[model samples]
Target: MNGRKNVVEVLIFKKEVEADPRFNVIGEVSLEDTDMLDHIGEGIDVKLIPI
Candidate 1:
């Protein structure tokens, strides 16, 4: 993180885990929201908000 621009990625985990820098896990989604993961495709529009 030495002045590098941050990157965001989406991962579908079959197991739960604590955040790890090696995996770049900034956060996670709820179980109910997992359904949306199946719909990701070429035109996906994503936005990140720092709540």
Candidate 2:
């Protein structure tokens, strides 16, 4: 994982719930874009927080 690149943390807000869930994913942004976007598309909002 040390030699890997394009790691990002994302917060997903699930529908039917009042809060969001945080997830850590290590990989290229493009690789996770669809799933992450779909999570948001399916009523889960995404918020990228700086660390």
Candidate 3:
């Protein structure tokens, strides 16, 4: 069997809400992991939309 790694990467950035609004609104995006995971894939624009 060919072995492959199912890996995911994450990067955390700290910034003022004015510098990056997305950082301030992560908590309001969604409560489900699927909702977050859906946005974190290849070619997907990773961002947290303020509700």
Which one is best on lDDT?
1
Please give the range of 10 consecutive residues that has the lowest summed lDDT in model 2.
11-20
Compared with the true structure, model 3 gives a TM-score of 0.23
Pairs with backbone N, CA or C atoms under 3 Å apart (clashes), candidate 2: none
lDDT per residue (tens digit) for residues 1-51 in model 3: 479866554443332244555444335333455445544555565654455
Of 1 and 2, the candidate ahead on lDDT is 1
- Estimate the TM-score of every prediction: 0.43, 0.22, 0.23
TM-score-superior candidate, 2 or 3: 3
User: Number of backbone collisions per candidate, in order?
Assistant: 0, 0, 0
> Which stretches in model 1 have alpha-carbon errors above 4 Å?
1-21
lDDT of 2 by residue, 1-51 (tens): 688777444444332344335534332344445566554554444455543
Candidate 3 — what's its lDDT? 0.46
Candidate 2 segments whose C-alpha is farther than 4 A from its true place: 1-3, 15-51
How displaced is residue 19 in candidate 1, in Å? 8.1
